[model samples]
Target: MQNRQQSEIVRDILTVCNGSGTTITNVMFHAYISHAQARGYLGELIDKGLIENDIFDSRQYRSTPKGLKYLAGLETMSELLAIETRRIAKSGANIC
Candidate 1:
């Protein structure tokens, strides 16, 4: 897989936790990251208050309200970028 940006990885993590609380292994597998990488990013997400360590299940991670908002914003920006990219590609072809 292509190397994704930090924001992209974080977005994926948020998505992974969106439906339910998940273990580090689930996040790592779903996000396609190694254990070391998962630890680092998960820690960062928790630090950023984007994810919360579930008290009832210490091993699980859940997305915070802020994380859900971030995910929504990221999806919006990606959609906008895709639209702009398609428009530019079409215009460039016309110029040729």
Candidate 2:
């Protein structure tokens, strides 16, 4: 799979939880990606076992263990980013 932007990857993680069920199309809409790109990205995520597509209900997808791990990592990264931003602000870096 090609390297995707962090926002796209993060959005893919969240897309599975949408109440309407998880399809590549739904994920694309959630992630604000074009339909074609969503299909390719969803295929890569499935192949990596980070996501599992429901065999009984093709439109549904769920996070796998690997996907949960990835989400945790992303959360940690987000926390770190927030901390750094706060530190810079406190230092009067004028980021705003």
Pick by TM-score: which candidate is best? 1
Worst 10-residue lDDT window, candidate 2: 81-90
lDDT of model number 2? 0.62
Write down the worst ten-residue block by lDDT for model 1: 81-90
Q: Which residue pairs clash within candidate 2?
A: none
Give the per-residue lDDT digits (tens) of candidate 1, residues 1-96: 445677677877898988679999999987889999999999998999989998998899999999999999987886665633332454674322
Q: Highest lDDT: which candidate?
A: 1
Candidate 1 overall lDDT versus native: 0.82
Task: Provide the overall lDDT of each model, using Cα atoms, as 2-decimal numbers.
Answer: 0.82, 0.62
Which sections of candidate 1 miss by over 4 Å?
83-96
Clashing residue pairs in all predictions, respectively, total 0, 0
Over 62-94, each residue of candidate 2 has an lDDT whose tens digit, in order, gives 777787787677666756666333224557764
